[model samples]
Target: MNENQSSRRRFVVSVGTAALVGLAGCGAQQGESAQTSTQQTTTQTETTTPTEAADTPTTTQKSSKSDADGPVVEMKTDNEGSYFDPKGLVVEPGTTVRFVNISGTHSTAAYHPDNDDGPLRIPDGADPWKSKLFTDTDAVFEHTFETEGVYDFYCAPHEMLGMVGRIVVGEPQGGPATESPTDIPPAAQESLPAVETIVSEQRVSGP
Candidate 1:
């Protein structure tokens, strides 16, 4: 072939090769994008599955407390944080309060000036009592509320760590109002909000 024809043939071949390579590169990029989308969809599905499963049981338990197992007064004593579960509770007079030892070496000690470690906040004529540390079934403490007033108590060792609680028997009657955070030990600062919530929102009229 002549030089002119030869040059034209080479140019056409080069152009054809470049077009083929560009098409291949585009196919590869599209494949990668499709793969990435599938992986992201799978990750989202996995994440949502556990959350949906977890929420159902939690919602059901909170919404439905069976009458058979429910009680007039109950409280939890946790070992891990060395604090009571509810922080405060309100119950009727003559009701029995069952303290479940949920965690720790805990005790229920009435707040009294005679204890010399804390203030006196029990109801008028209410007897003061203290339970021994968790050493068996003694881990469980039960107190009957016979007076209509506020009773404050603490865990022996964890009181300094803010491990304290209160019980309001029947409706509040001439009891000290909601206590300020400044009145409690410095360690109990975190518990002040819970104290306020129970005192204001949980009080029940004695039946």
Candidate 2:
């Protein structure tokens, strides 16, 4: 072979060997790091993130305020939406829930049989008491809940307009009194929001 042919052949062999060495180096690098990268990815996926706005149960009991100074559910007029303002509350047992007439006549009566309108409902062994026509403003009627249960009440006149409210008295000694709202009167049942809404969202203090 001539000198040029020999030089060209040597250059070609050198290039092929360098390429083989480069491919081997790349394989070794991938083999070393592939497992580590996979481990890192799995760790990132397994980490748990915190939630937003965790729901907390809160209960507001009746302070030392007298019947006149207590929380007043407004007796709304035709112009105003005829629903109980605040809709529900959590009060201590023996705390008297006072219903004050604001405009229209309203009644805060329980879903109990003593009212001649129930079949052992709302609360057990609890006398259902409703006020006479509360036509004047600040005209009040009150009931002290000694039992630990959910009490749903409604206005006799405007119950169809969804004029209703709920009260959770002390820490309930019982689980959900009723499985569902099937037994409750359809007008009264549909009037108020579910009592679960009050029980789950609120807790009674001092007990």
Candidate 3:
């Protein structure tokens, strides 16, 4: 073959090889870019799914200051009769107690002279409280105890039925509530918790 022809053939073969290599490099770069994009999308989905689920909220009832500080006493009625649950309770000074009526008609009245001219049972000079009759279910009455002594109260209408309760603010005190009363009925007097029991147990259930 002539020298010029051989040189031209070699040059054409070299040019074709270079073009093939360039095309292969461009195809590899495109594939790598596509893989990286897919990985990024998968990572974002995995990270965000759990975060959204963790932000969900739950429902609950609101609590009042009175409920948070003192215990709840329930007035309930059964086949036997109507009575106050936890007939006796002990609390710190300034604690507000919540009285809830579960069933039957009821009222909480302090054994003070101001209330129906009853005997003085609570601490002297302490504020008196008397609740109206509760005929419906889920009725609520609240009272704050500021005096540090024994408080004797009863269900006015049902007092004859022996529905009575006692509350000790901080300690026991010498009062009409502490002594055995001859004025009230036997059942009503008996329903009143003993001062010793209320101080020791902190809570006493109805008879």
Candidate 4:
């Protein structure tokens, strides 16, 4: 073959080889980009699934006491009488009773059958169990009934005029309204101070 023709053929072959190499490099780059995009999409999906599941609303359990089971009573002190509005309250063993004192100088005192006989007055280590005398303004108290029994309490200064209240804590086997009698301490029953029931109006605010 002639020298110039051989040189031209060699140049053409070199150009073709260079073009093939460039195309292979472009294919490899595209494959790597596709892999990276797929991985990012998978990661985002995994992160969002758990967050959406956590945001789902959960159901709350209801209390055992039905609306018809017991009456929602109030303890109020008014001009006519300074005493517990309902005079009595009934609750189940696991029920929680809230005492909102709206008026008068009063306290929910629950001493043992013999407060003077020893230090076994009221339950041991009860948290805010005893409500202090309401001399200044209105206050609120709450207690949970865990044991199945009756709890008798009297006002510190108004027990003489029969300012007493009872908490029947537990389910009655026979039927509703059945309660066991609570024993009041002798010292508490002896002489309760006589104080005028201070009547005051309380403003309760809520939505």
Candidate 5:
């Protein structure tokens, strides 16, 4: 072969090798950039996950007796025995009464014909309320008094034991509860608070 042709062939080979190396370097740089972009995307997704969890709603808590719409009554036990803590209460019409069981099994039942065929002790047109036996501590029941009259309630299982109470709504008015009770047990008759006393005192505690 001739000298010029050999030299020209060498130069061509050298230029081709340099071009391939440059292309390889560019490919490596592009691959690294793509990998970095993917890593940044994964990091962004991880950072937003905790914020989503923080935005989730939480459970609501139960309201306390002080937050009730009206007065609160507690069915509790003491050295004397099981009974309503405040034997009598006086409230305004449309007031709600919250009955909370502090201890032992008890219930807040109105003296009504629907409950054990008892005579109506609440106002004639007033709605009767009866609660199931509350055995769980802190169990609660609520009733709203729309009528302006006396209300006499008893604990069914403990009525004979004198677990009875009274409530006078607004001014004292005529009702079966205001009259002398004839159908109740002797203990309940003695334990029930007087409407006059409830009105004057606003609250009467048990004996």
Candidate 6:
């Protein structure tokens, strides 16, 4: 072969090899870019899904203050007469009775065994029981009964005028109501002079 012909064939072969190498490089770059784009899309999807779930609301529950499995009783106060509206009350042991004083200048005082004034006597070894005195500025008294027996009480100032009450603490026998007689122990019962009931209005502040 001639020298110029050999040189032209060599140049053509080199140009063809160069074109194949450029094509392979471009194909590798395209495959790498496509893989990176797919990974970025997967990461974005994983991040956004949890954020959307966190924004949704979740359910919650609440509780009540009173138990539905216990017994309920109501007692009222009266001022038109010098006696408790329901002069007699019955409750089970460990029951709480709320005494709402309707008028002022009244108190529920237990009859001391010695029949004295200040403090009164409760049943032997029973939980200490005392109701706050509802005076001209105080109006409510609450007491919890924790023993089984009968309790007789009278007002400190009006015991002479027949202002008295009784509380029978225990489970009722035979589901019947027991009447409280005017004659209770520790205090003699006698019908006295009736006095007109006085209605007094007063505001009480809380501690």
Best by TM-score: 5
lDDT of each: 0.49, 0.51, 0.67, 0.37, 0.70, 0.37
Lowest summed-lDDT stretch of 10 residues in model 4?
Answer: 41-50
Expressed as tens digits, the lDDT of each residue in 89-187 for candidate 6 is 555665555444555456665554333432333344333323434442223344456556555556655556556655566632211112333334333
| TM-score preference between candidates 4 and 5, better one | 5
lDDT comparison, 1 vs 4, better candidate:
1
* Candidate maximizing lDDT: 5
For candidate 4, lDDT tens digit of each residue in 1-207?
112211011111122222222234435354432222222111000000111232221221223223353333244466655565444444555555555556666665454323222222222222113454554343434445455444455666765555655455442232111222223434433322211111111111110
Better of 1 and 6 by lDDT: 1
Total clashes for model 3: 0
Model 6's TM-score against the true structure: 0.41
* CA RMSD of each candidate after superposition: 27.9, 31.2, 32.8, 31.4, 30.9, 37.0
Cα deviation of 95, candidate 4, in Å: 1.7
Considering only N, C-alpha and C atoms within 3 Å, which residue pairs clash in candidate 4? none
Write the residue-wise lDDT of candidate 2 on 13-75 in tens digits.
122222222234435354432222222111000111112222211213332335455555555
Decide which is better by lDDT, 1 or 5. 5
Worst 10-residue lDDT window for candidate 2 reads 41-50
Candidate 5 lDDT, 4-76, residue by residue in tens: 2110111111222222222344343544322222221110000001112322212112346663445778898
Total backbone collisions, model 2: 0
The TM-scores, one per candidate, come to 0.53, 0.57, 0.66, 0.42, 0.68, 0.41
Q: Across residues 1-207, which tens digit of lDDT does each residue of candidate 3 receive?
A: 112211011111122222222234435354432222222111000000111232221211223424564588888778868788889999988676777778888888878776687887887656556777777566566666766788888898889989989998887767666777666767888888888999999999985
What's the TM for model 1? Answer: 0.53
Off by over 4 Å in 1: 1-80, 135-138, 176-183, 189-196, 203-207
- Winner on lDDT between 2 and 5 is 5
